[model samples]
Target: MGSGKHRWKISIYRSTGKPETRNPNPPTEFICPISGLLMADPVIVSTGQTFERACVTACKTLGYNPILKDGSIPDLSIVIPNLALKSSIFNWARASMTDPPKAVELADALKLVRPAMAENGEIENGVLGELLIGRVEEDNRGSNLLEHAESELTRRQTGFDSCESLSGSFRKTPLALATRPSCYSSCSSSSELDAPAVGACEDGEEYVGKLRSSHVYEQEQGVVGLRKATRSSEDLRLSLCTPRLLSALRPLITSKYNNIQINSVAALVNLSLQKLNKVKIVRAGFVPLLIDVLRGRFPEAQEHACGALFSLALDDANKTAIGVLGALQPLVHIMIRSESERARHDAALALYHLSLVQSNRLKLVKLGSVQLFLGMVKSGQMPGRALLILCNLAACNEGRGAMLDAGAVEFFVGLLREGGFDSESTRESCVAAISALSYGGGLRFRGLAKAAGAVEVLRDVAEQTGRERARDKARRVLEILKAREEEEEEDVDWEKVLELGFPSRTLTRVGGQSCRNSSEF
Candidate 1:
C-alpha cells in the first residue's frame, strides 16, 4: 500500500487466495477484553491494552488488569479513547447484515406442522417435542437470521397489526371428533367388495363420509408460524430486534391462542435480557400484559411473566413504570397466593426490585409488604431478596418507622445472629438493615437496635466474619451505635439516596419516568 510517497509492505494470510471468500468480519483485537461485546466506548488502559471503558473501570477498581498479570494500574485516569477503532466498529455494524446468508432464508421460510389429521385432538406421543426441537435446531443453525431480520426491520420501520387483527387467526371453528362408521366391523380386509360405502368400496378402497374441517386446525397453524418466528428471533439474542419484535408480539400476546401467547411471552422474556430492550418493551405495552399473565390461572405463563419482569426491573428505569401501571397489587397477590413455588419466588424478586425506590418502598410497606417479607423469610422463599427489600425499606425514615413498628428489626437481627439463614448475602443484608436503621433513624433506632440484641450480632460479625464486606458493614453499624448514641439523625435525604448507589432509581421514585413525554425528555 502507498501512503503519500511512502510504501508499506503488509502480509495477508489466506487459506485459499480467493478475495471473494475472504472473511470480512472484524479482528479479535477490536473486541473488549473484559466484556467480549463490541467496543462502543473503547479506551486504552495503562497496561497498553484496550478495553471498553465500563469494563476497564470495574476491573481497575478491583485493582487488577484482567488480561495481564501486572497486578494493578497506578491509575485509570490515564486511559485514552480509541476513536479510530470506534469508527471502524460503527462501519462494520452498519454493513454487517448487507450480505445475508442462505441459511437465514431457509430458516425463515421453514415450517413445522402436521396435516389436518391432528384435528382429532389426540397428540401422538413425542410428536410435539420433536416438532419444537426440530424448529429450534433449525433456528440454532441459522445464527445470522436475527441480525438480518433486525437490519431489515429497521430499514422498513413498519408497524404491526392490532390486537383484533392478531386475534383473527385465533377465532376459529371449535374442534370436532370424527367417529368410526358402525359398518366397519363387518367390512372385509380386501378384494373389491362393491357395496354400501360404509361397509366396503367398489374397488376395495375404503369409502368414508366427508370429514368436517375445524377452525381449531387453522388456529394451530397460526400458532406454529408465530412460534417459529419467535424461536428464530429468540435464538439470535440481539437487542437490535427488540422494538420490532415487541411490536409484533404485543398484539399476539392478547390473542386467545394460548400457544401463540405463550411463545410471544417467552420471546419477550428472551428479548428483555438485552439492556436496551427493557424500555422499548415497556413502551410497547408489555408490562401490563406480563402483569395480566402473572395474575392469570396458567402457572407456566405466570412464571415466564414473573421472570421477564424480574429481568426488566433490573434496569432501575423500568421499575416505577411497572409499579405505576397497577402491577403492585397483583404482584403482591402472586407472592401471597400463587401456588407454584417458582412463581412465588419470582414474584418476590420482582418486589425486591420495586422496593428499591423510595416511593415504591413506601407504597409496598403501606400495602402489607412488611408482613409479606416476614412470612417469606420464615418460609425460605427468596430469603436474600426478602432481606434486601427489608433493608431498602429501612433506607427511608417513614419505611423505617413502619418496619420498626412491624418488629422487623428484631426478626432480621435474630435471623442473622442465630445462623438461621445460611447465605452470606442474607446475613449481610440483615447487617445492612441494622446499619440503615441504626445510623439514620435517631435514638429510637439505637435503643431499638440494642433491644433487638443487634449489638451482640454486630460484634459477632465484626469480630468473627470472613467476608470483608460484611465485617466492614457490621463495624460501621457498631460505631454508629457505640460512638454517638444520641447524635442528631434524619430520614434518608436525596444526597444520601445518591450515596447509596441508586441514581436512576431515585429519578423514577421521585417522578418524570414516563416514556410518552418526549418534550420533557
Candidate 2:
C-alpha cells in the first residue's frame, strides 16, 4: 500500500508537468492578433499592432489586408522587432510552468490564413479567385484594398478563364497552392517543381507561383523573370506587387544563394519604382527586410536594397514609417562604410528623402549622422550626396543644432574656399546647406561663420559661382552675416547710450565739437 501510494504521487506530478494541462489561455497581449497563437517572434507593425512575424508575412503573401476587430486595417509596411514583448512572453511562459510557444513556420502560417478550400477540394472562388484572376481593386484614393472581392468575383471569372486558356501548359498555370500535397496526390511533386526548365513565363502570377515553389532554382528563375518584366513595364510593376509576390520575395532577400538574393532584392527595387506600389510595398513589410539586406554579407543584394529604400523613401507616406522602423542607422552606416559606390549613393539619397521628415531628421541627429556626413564631405567621399542630406537635416531644429555642433560652418566654408568640386550641383548643395544653417542657427551660426572666415568665402562664391541658385544662396548667407553684425553693433550702441543716461544721437560731433540736438533728444 505504501509503494502504490508513492507511485500515484509520482504519476500526478508527471501529469501536471505535461504541456496540455498547462494554462491554455495566456494574456491577451501575449497572443498574436493575426495568428491567434502566442507570438514566438513578436513585431510591432506600422499601425502599432503586435503580431507574429510569420503571420504578417503570410497575410502579406495572401494580400489580405484584414480589417481588425477595431475596424481599422493594420499597415504592414514597417515592422520593428519587438524584443521587449518577446522577452515578456518568455517570462510569462516560464512563470506559468509551460513550454513556450514554438515559432509558426511560413507553411503553417499560410495554411492558417489562406482562404478556405471547398468541400469538393476545389479552390474556393472568392478572395483567392480574384487574386488568381489578377484583378486589383483600388479605392477612390487609389489605395488598393480587398473589400470588393466577392462583388467582383463573377466579373473576374471570365478573365481567369481567358488567362487559363492562354497558358495551356500545366507548367504555365499561375495558381499558387498553400498546402504541400502528399505522395498519393496528383499534384506535381516537389522534385519536379524544383526543375531548372525556366521557360518564357511572361505572366506575373505565374512567376509569383514559381517564387513560392520549394526549389531554390525555381525561385531564382521566378525572381529573375519578375525583375526583368518589372524593369521596363510600368503595368507589370503595378500588377505584380501583390502581398503574395512580396511575401514570396521577402525570405529570398536573405537567401543563401548569391544569384537568388541579388535578383530578389533587385526585383523589389524595380517594383518599388512605381508610385502606386511604394506605400503598398512598405505596408507589406519590405522596409525591415531591406534594412537587413543592407547589413547582410551580399554586396550586390545590398546595392539593390539601398536603391529600393531610396525608391520607397520618395513617397511621403512611407518616409516616417521607414525612419520609425530603424532604417536610419543602417542607411548611415552603409552610406559611410559600403564599398559599392552605387550602394553608398543610393543610401545617401535614401537618407536625404528620409530626412525630409522632421522626426527622421531628429533621428539622424540622434544617430550622430551629422558629424559622419560632415566628415565624409571633408574627406571628398560622396560630398555631393552628403551635402544634400545635410541640407535636408538643416530644415529641422535638431538637425541644424547638430550641424553647428559638428563644425559644419568651417567645413562648407573650406569646401567653397578650395573650389574644385566635380559639378556645379555639389557647390550648390554646399551653399544651400550653409544657407539653411545660417537661417536656422541664429546667433550661433553667425559666430561660427565669422570664426570660419565664411564672410569672405561667400562673397567670392556670390560673385563667381555659375549656378544662379548657388550664387543666390551664397548671397543669402552673406546677407544673414551682415544683418547679424549690424544687429550686434546696434545692441552695443544702445547699451552705450543707456550707460551715459542719454541718446547717443542726441549729442553729435561736428568737426570734433559736440553739437547738442535738443529737439531730436
Candidate 3:
C-alpha cells in the first residue's frame, strides 16, 4: 500500500484513428487494463493494475492495496478493476477529446462496463463501493458524505516506501475492515456527487446483480450530474446580467436573501444613476419599490432596503420622485420602529433629503414630523441621522419655527453639552440652526435666544469655534443680534428713559424755569 503523497498518473489510449503517444511527458496516453479504453494524460486510478504511486498511497490510507500493470487489454470480469480502470479511461478521454459526442460515447462505454465489473468480487469493498454506500446513506439522511469520508480517512495510518514495486496488492487490516461498514454508512447518497449516481440507479432492473445494483448507480449519477450542470450554468448565466437580475430580485428580499439582494440592487442602482437618462427609470419606479421593500417582515430586509433607498435618494431627481410617492411617512415608520441601525440611518437620510424641498419640508412639518425628529435627537439615538434631519428641517421657515416650538434649541443645547455635537452632523445642524435664527422671522429669533438657555448654548458653541466657518457663522449671528439691539435702543422713549435713570435732570429743568419766573415778578 502507498501513502497519499505518491500519486499515480494513468493514461488510456483510445484509437481515434490516430497514433497515440504514451510517455512521462506531454500528450501521454494509456489503454485501461480493465475496459481497454483509450485514456489520456494525468489519469488517476484508485484500483486495478495501473494504479500510480499517489493512487496507491491514497488507497493504502483507505486500508486497501491497489495493483498496477502496463497492458493494452483490460480485464472486464473484475468489478473493482473494471470500474476504476474505466473511470480513469473515461476521465482521460473526456479531458483530451474536444468533440462532445466522442466524450459522451466514451462516458457511455464506461457506463456499460460498470455493472459487469460491479458484479464481480473486484468492485465490492473497493473505494467506489464504500463511497457509493456512504453516499446513499447520506442522501437518505440528508447529510454530507465527503465530510464523513475525510474524518474516517484521518484515523487510518498512511506511509510510503522507496522503490516500491507496483505488482502486489495491499490488504486491509482487521481494524480497517471493521470500520469499512461505518464508512459506507457515512457516505450514503446525500453528498453533492451522489445525485448523478442515484439518477443512474432509478431503473427497476438490477445492474451488476450481487455486488451492487446498476439502477442505484445510474440514478445517483444522474442527480449528481444534473446538480453540477445546474450550478455551472447558473454561475455563467448570473454573471452576464448581474445588475438587472439584482434589481429584479429586490422584491424577493428577506432575512435569508437580504444581503444578496441589497448588494445586487446597490450595484445596479449605483451604475444606473451614474448615467443621465437611466436615472429616470430608477426614479420613476425603483424608488417606490425600494420604499415598499422597507416594509419587509425581516429586520435585515428592512435594513438593506433602507440602505438601497438612501443610495438612490442621493440623486436629486430620485429624492423628489420619492417624495412624490409619499415615502416620508413610511420611511419615518421604519426609522422609528425598526431597530436596525442601517434602516434608521437611511430613513433619517431620506427625511433629510425630502426636507430640502420647500413643499416636502412644509408637509413634513404639517405631519408633526419635526416633533418626532426633535425627540429622536433628544433621545440620543442615531444622533448623526437626527442632526441631518434637523439641519434640513431648519432650512424651512415653518420648519424652523416648528423646531423652535418643539424645543429643538434646548435639545440641541443638551446635545452640545453631552458632547453629541462633536460629530460633523451635529456641527452642521448647529450652523443651520444659527443661520435660520439669524434670518428667520424676528419673533422666532427673539423666542430662540430668550428661551430658557439657548443664548448661552450659542455662546458656548461660539467659544468653541476654532474653524473659520464656525467662527464666521457665529460672528454673523452676533452681529445681527447686536444690530437689532442698537435699533431698539434708538427707538426707546427719552423721557421715560430719563425718569428711570436720571430724575434729577427733570428736577433741574423745573428749578431753572421757576428762577426765571421769579426774576420777572
Please name the candidate that would achieve the greatest lDDT relative to the true structure: 2
Candidate with the larger lDDT of 1 and 2: 2
Considering TM-score, which of the candidate structures 1 and 3 is the better prediction for this target? 1
Residue lDDT tens for model 2, 1-521: 99999999978977887554466578999998767899999998754678999988776655454445543445565679999999999998887776888999999987876642232133422234324323321112111111111111111110111122111111111123211101111222233244343554456679878888998767878877776666556567778888877887888888888778777877787677565688999998888888888888888778778878887885667889999999999989998998976677667767766776678988888888888888898888877778777877886788888888878888889888988986666777787778777753388888889899998999998798396656766776787678778877976776676667654354557677776664453
Candidate 2: worst 10 consecutive residues by lDDT?
A: 152-161
TM-score of 1: 0.51
- Model 3 RMSD in angstroms: 32.3
Ranking by lDDT: 2, 1, 3
Model 3 Cα lDDT, one tens digit per residue, 79-172:
2334554455555545655321122243444454455444433342334333342343523421231232222222211111110221111121
| True-structure lDDT of candidate 1 | 0.53
260: Cα error in model 3, Å: 8.2
Q: Which stretches of candidate 3 lie over 4 Å from their true place?
A: 1-278, 417-425, 492-521
